[model samples]
Target: MHLIITDAWLARSRAIHLSGTRLLLVGVLASVFLMLMTVSVYHWLVVAGAGEGGGRLGRFVLNDEMAQRERFMRENLDAMARKVGEMQARLLQLDSLGERVSGLAGVSAIKAPPPAGQGGALIASRSLTVQELDALLRELNIAAEQRSDWMTMVESRLLDEKIRKSMVPTQLPTATGVLGSPFGWRIDPLTGRSALHTGMDFQAAQGEAIVAAAGGVVVTQEYHAEYGQMLEIDHGNGLVSRYAHASRVWVKKGDLVRRGQKIAEVGTTGRSTGPHLHFEVLVQGVPQNPEKFLVAGRDLPNTRSVATKSP
Candidate 1:
């Protein structure tokens, strides 16, 4: 690049030549000066509010934007507060359900904590800031999660125990009958001598239906010398029930029977004075007190040994 300058100020023409490097330097300096002037003018305009409707419009716009931001923040805080309140209510409901389940399963009931103290001097309160509300929400969320997990475990255990109890034989064999003899020492009807009766007897009409005490599989169905037509049921968990002196047997060996299902008919087919059903409960091949399981199932009080005569 080249540049030429001519001056005719005193009747004499003068010429000057510039190199490419010098010309480039001058152009760069001019550009820098223009940039600085532009920056200074912009700064002055903003400070003096010269282009924003005499400064009132600029201040109004800024204030409006700030107000909008504050409103949005307040709305978010209110929503969070409502969510926390709902969680607290749900936690209380879970606690109540847990208490009822514990009582039904015979577990030790846990007392609910006492109500929090609320007595204090009444005073004006300020709105909570965002940071404070956030901290409170986090704490409440953790507590709720722990309680939910605990309640779920308790509910599962209660359900499992209830199912297991249903499969055990604890109910009476005869639907309606009077207790003929207790399960302890008794006089044999045929021999007329003191004998240890291993089973409890129920007096019912001949051919009356005899139901199973619990859900189980029939293990034996045959005639016996002492207990004519007898049927044995093998309940799971080493428990079994025997029904003897049946006039007729409705179930065969290996047949599945549910609780309260008719399995035989009461009669005096064996050594007995009258029509009756001999019901016995055995645990692990050993005879156990049937009355114990009966009382446990019915949740009845342990009183004196007495007969229950059905009306």
Candidate 2:
């Protein structure tokens, strides 16, 4: 090696020179380093998973890791956006399912039923975590239970309506019948004195077919001295209607019969009188006005009778 004092400066800063094989070796080494730097810049721009773009080698050296980090951050943001979309879809599905359950339960509105756990509606509305979702499920279960109870009530009401409609007589026991004696006070039949008639009497031709007033189980069928042949039916709901002065009994005890079913034949069997049926309405063993109930269908006119009839 050689050194030449070309400028008056520090010794370390003095000019140096090389020649022959040494100078040629330095030139070759410098060429190889430039080639390696060019290849590295191309690899970083195209083959390092970073998008290819035209940039200077100097810029590539300063932003090597930065390119990879930018791509990673972009992917993370896309994943986050997808997650948000999926969450919104799940929320919409939950809302649709809730509306269906409400309709099945016959509720016009969808509101979470109150439950013991958690504070109140505030907790459900603000519910976001797993524990909050569990609380919401509990509230929904409570609402379903209440709907079950309400359905039971509706069934009971429906049953009562059916029973009432059945118990109300659809027609008079006799076809060509007239109200001979109404329910309540009147004169005695054999005693010839004032008495309480507990039933309404329908006068008709002897040997006429008499039908049951309602659908129920036949409770009593027997021959009697004062009422002749008597038939009684016990409808459910604390109701029992009686038919007296029958010539023949068609239904025996414990026999089920529908309304308007033939139950007896009307005739003068015991007491001296024309054929008549003594119809009574006893609710919980207490006598009620039979005429009021009978007029619903029979439209029986008001009649005054100085007589006491049996049921």
Candidate 3:
């Protein structure tokens, strides 16, 4: 490559020569300097624009994205809160039900021990995190399950108690009868001697209805020399009741009978002077006072000997 220089004031011209390698080096340097100028102008324009509209535009976009995330999080938290509230309401209902069941079962309500005392000055209350809310829900669920199990056990106990009470002899044997000879030591009408009467005598007309005192299975339905045409009912728990001196038997052995059900007709079929019904309540084959079971609203004394047996 060649370049020409002219000096106008001196009116002189000169010629210079360059090699190909030097020309290539000059081209590279010129290109590099243009690139440097371009980069400097770009940096100046960016820095100046940052204080104007460009900075606000960038921040607005970032803020909008953050708001979307916050809204999503709030929706999720609200849903969880509603669920927790519902669970708490259900737990309260369960507590109330437990109290009612305890009353029905005739048992005192079992209460949890009081919590340890804790108090502090109101400083600040912060929103719960997701982890905390989840933990609370789990605790509520566990409490509900425990309450359900407790209610089931209470129901079972109540059922058992109801069935047990049904087996107790609380009903009267005869609806229309007058009390005659009481259950204790008395003069034997036939022997004319002092003897223990194991049962109470109910004076009634012949063919009067004689009902069972309790619900049980008939265990004995046959004739005895002393207690003729007798019927015995086993009222569970080693308790039994005997209806003796009946004219006619309406139930047989192994027959299930309900309380107050007619099982015989009163008569003087046994060694009795007149038409009467002999009612006896025996505990494990030993005689107990029939008044102790038949008489209402009174707690009678246990005056009869425990070793005494019905002859």
Top candidate on TM-score is 1
Best by lDDT: 3
Candidate 1 per-residue C-alpha lDDT over 1-311 given as tens digits, one digit per residue, 9 for 90 to 100: 53445465655554567688888898999999999998776555545677766466656766899999999988888887777778778777877886787777666544556879887887886567888888878877777777767667777777887657666777677766478787888778778899889888888899999988778899999999888899999988889999999999999999999877899999988777788998889988888878777666665222223258554
Arranged by TM-score with the best first, the candidates are 1, 3, 2
Better of 1 and 2 by lDDT: 1
lDDT per residue as tens, model 3, 1-311: 78999999999999988899989999999999999998775554444445556556656666898999998998889887877989788777767777888888876664655669999899997556899898998888778777777877888888897567556665667765467888999999999899999998887889999988778999999999989999999999999999999999999999999877899999888788999899999999999998767653123221112222223
Pairing residues by index, what is the TM-score of model 1? 0.62
Segments of candidate 1 deviating more than 4 angstroms: 1-50, 54-69, 89-124, 129-134, 248-257, 268-274, 300-311
Each model's TM-score, in the order given? Answer: 0.62, 0.46, 0.59
lDDT of 2 by residue, 1-311 (tens): 78766544643456577878888999899999999998986776655634535435435665877888877766765565555557546644655675665464444434444447754455333214445445555755565565556556555665766666777654566665567888788888878899898888887777788887778988888888877788878888888888888878888999999877888887777774676777787888998887666656543222122223333
Q: What C-alpha lDDT, on a 0 to 100 scale, does residue 300 get in candidate 2?
A: 26
lDDT of each: 0.79, 0.70, 0.81
Best-first order by lDDT: 3, 1, 2
Instruction: State candidate 3's TM-score.
Output: 0.59
